[model samples]
Target: MIGFSILNTINTDNDDLSGLNEIPFTVSYVTSIHRAQGLEYKNVKLVITDDDKTNMTHDIFYTAITRAKENLEIFWNAETQKFVIDNFEEQTQKWNKEIALINAIKNNK
Candidate 1:
């Protein structure tokens, strides 16, 4: 489990109630990339196991990398590393092309 503390301020029209507060929470150490979408964290650790290679996609990898706001660590075996290197550029270009097509369609509508 990972623990987090966040400071928040409380405000009210009443003169006696405005103050700073601390909120604490705990979260699991591991979560799926899909489940983590639209959330950002101070640090992220991504592990790609041999079993993951078969189902891994560029979008999933991209999402995991982007989730880290300040630091990111990635762990994978040599085979997974090679898989990323071999497909990275091609996949990026393909996604870019798809994005352009989507934008063109939206502009025409």
Candidate 2:
């Protein structure tokens, strides 16, 4: 596996190349959802494996889907499909309850 690391340089001059000691190399196209946070891409391809689903959360799934600016594709098995459905339903119910409470408060005022 190829790993990439970030280098911090204190020099402000663009002509100072002495700070760079290592040769430039390419990085993998794949990245974790956590690492991709606050970043947008023209296209995104997401793959969900059984191991991934074990640690998957609603927020992570949402973040993955929203990463794509123009197009997004997802690949998963039936088990993962069921898990996504259940998670969506749970989130929907939670939002509905919150909205109801807000409406009730407004009526009581």
Candidate 3:
């Protein structure tokens, strides 16, 4: 059993605490990413399981990364890492070729 105690006044009869003053809480850090959106943090570590990665999209990744104010670390398996690295390299090569073409056109004019 967790060794945590609290002194809180709970009213099961009324939804509104009309005459009751209480501090009710048991644990923390139990929240979903959807609920965490629009909130910022100094550092964010996202742990992605195989199941989660299967449904992850760019928009979701963007949202998760933007939540971090300074640092963002994504923890994933080898499969996800390989996918990220391969896609990144492919996109980088395409951009490099496009930039080179643009420079050549400008120099010829």
Candidate 4:
């Protein structure tokens, strides 16, 4: 028994991958966050390449972090270290505010 796969990199001019079906055995998998919704894993390692603050929102960060059931790890390149740090600091402030609000509500109750 043997298996093979075709790694087709989509380009601006070529988008047709249907022709690959004639090759008998070819497979590809998508690990995108949108597609990973509803799936849970014991451990997850997420590596974010995009450091743009506009693209990396709190919701997106939360979604990616919450995917792991037990342990989750994150890695960023040196080029984006400052950006990552800034975002994390901002998010930490929001998290602390939320925690304080919850504590206030609990104390009132």
Measured by lDDT, the strongest candidate is: 2
Model 2: lDDT to the true structure: 0.83
Cα lDDT of model 4 by residue, 1-109, tens digit: 3355564555547766754432354343337666677787777777777644446756666777788899988877776656866877898899999999999999999
Candidate 4, overall lDDT? 0.70
**Each prediction's whole-model lDDT (CA):** 0.81, 0.83, 0.71, 0.70
* Model 2 TM-score, 2 decimals: 0.57
Stretches off by above 4 angstroms in model 4 are 1-30, 50-54, 78-81, 85-109
- Score every model by TM-score: 0.56, 0.57, 0.48, 0.44
Local error of candidate 2 at 20, Å?
36
Please give the TM-score that candidate 4 achieves against the real structure: 0.44
What would the per-residue lDDT of candidate 2 be over residues 25-47, giving only the tens digit for each residue? 64549999999999999889999
Model 3, global lDDT: 0.71
The per-prediction tally of clashing pairs is 0, 0, 0, 0
Displacement of the residue 54 alpha carbon in candidate 4, Å: 5.2
* lDDT by residue for model 3 (11-109), tens: 476555455544555443534578779998877888877777655655576677788899888899999866755655676788899999999999999
Whose TM-score is higher: candidate 2's or candidate 4's? Answer: 2
Better of 1 and 3 by TM-score: 1
lDDT comparing candidate 1 with the true structure: 0.81
* Span of 10 residues, lowest total lDDT, candidate 3: 1-10
CA RMSD per model (angstroms) = 15.0, 11.9, 9.4, 9.0
